[model samples]
Target: MNLTERLAAQPMSNPRADRVKDVAGLAGRSARSKRGLFLAEGPQNAREALARHLESPCVDAVYVTEDALGRHPDIAALLERVAGDRSVFVRLVTREVLAAMSDAVTPQGVVVVCPSLDVAAEEVLAAGPRLVAVLARVQDPGNAGTVLRAADAAGADAVVLTAGSVDVYNPKTVRSTAGSLFHLPVVVGADLPELLRAAREAGCGVLAADGHGDVDLDRLQDASAARAAGAEGVDAVYDLARPTVWLFGNEAQGLSAQEKALADHRVAVPVHGRAESLNVGTAATVCLYASARAQRRGADRP
Candidate 1:
């Protein structure tokens, strides 16, 4: 029942053990899907998973290294707080065993097994979210994760990954999120057209980020500012403060003409420098922040 006993009880020492292989198997989508579990590696992710566990008990177990415990006393304390839960499992392990269970060359010495983070598209849309980011067929894990984090930082109510997008549970994607994965609702494998239709029905104006669009990002900001400053009705060409969904696409291909056409408007993020374009994450960050700022400027209105 004490700390010492808990630490020694389930010592995971062998990298080749079947148990270790089972944990490492979670790195693959099929394995994760079959077992209904995935891995959250490193200290920050473990803490975030536990924080969510406190709310819903989705974390199945935690495996950690002794060195990691010494370096991160916070992880030690966190494990202690959750130790009493009969449903949760915590174990001490050799660094090699921890490494074997992770994709990282030098594992963070902590990994938590968690159920998939998917909430239904309905759950994300149920509240009629004011701001959202939609990733359409985005193939890169890092890009997806960064956009997720950016969306969270900009106070987006939800993020949706269309059917062909990278898995949010991909280890690289999870790492890039830097714990923002736990900060907001993320819906995966959604049908883009249906999702957009739902958003429209929920009073959301969909905007696609495109380079050749007629609407310029600077112009949109200017219009929002003018409206906030009590400008006449017609001067307000676009209302960024209103409920909106931002549509973003793959890093290489960008949004297709068909995809851009799904939105009520196609807005361009102007390129001032000679650079060709902004990557998906940067564009999403700028777009979401614009929405957040304008939405917060309600003081200038009623």
Candidate 2:
């Protein structure tokens, strides 16, 4: 039977059900680790997860309120498409049940339980990616998710969160991704030094985003632009068009000396407005887009 038929047959009304508690337990790291499952709360996240389910069947089940289904026709349509698939379950729940299953303050009426999506660092490096973002010791869940979203927007091949970083599956981080979590490959619990070594071996130049660094981002872009335009006698410091891995450090302390040492060069994003500094997410977006522009421009060159 399809989702609509199943919903009419038996709606989930109890907030205190064992099944509801099992889904809610995913908010805790220990429970998520044990079950290898995570919650994708809200319509935005649920839509993305459902779309991915159509592609690869990563979603385990979907729980939603009738009001939410009416409001988001796209989500409802996607759920109908996957309704017949035995691997994915769809259930209609009360608002109270959805709230009990969500970690958000104001739960958005839809939630999906999905398996962990992180890939191994080796697998990503083996793909010969041209652009990568590495989060080293980034502790804030919001910062981590924002950087991942930025990387996805910048068309990065993958994002790696090192061992000391926040859990990629943290509900705040997952929500912060705003559906970008399912858009790209992410590596979690990676060793910083080892991943750097692998990236270097894969022919990627490692650059660290440092606020106090000597290598200026503006100069690199200018050099890249000059080279792309076939300017003569333009000696570039480091080619932004080359395959690169950008290391973004912690929100509070930035990259430690040891982490900085692992990169080919430390690049500073110029600040002309006299603001203290760019947050990690903003800095990562600027740096990733810089490389993306340079790379695309280079690809267009004769």
The stretch of ten residues in a row with the least summed lDDT in candidate 2 is 2-11
Best prediction by TM-score: 2
TM-score of each: 0.96, 0.98
lDDT of 2: 0.93
Cα error, candidate 2, residue 216 (Å): 0.3
Mind sharing the TM-score for model 2? 0.98
Q: lDDT by residue for model 2 over 124-210, one digit each (tens)? A: 999999999999989999999999999999999999999979999999999999999999899999999989899989999999999
Clash counts per candidate, in order, are: 0, 0
**Residue pairs in steric clash, candidate 1?**
none
Q: Which runs of model 1 end up more than 4 angstroms from their true locations? A: 1-4
Q: How far is candidate 2 from the true structure (C-alpha RMSD, Å)?
A: 0.9
Model 1 C-alpha RMSD to native: 1.5
Q: Cα lDDT of model 1 overall?
A: 0.88
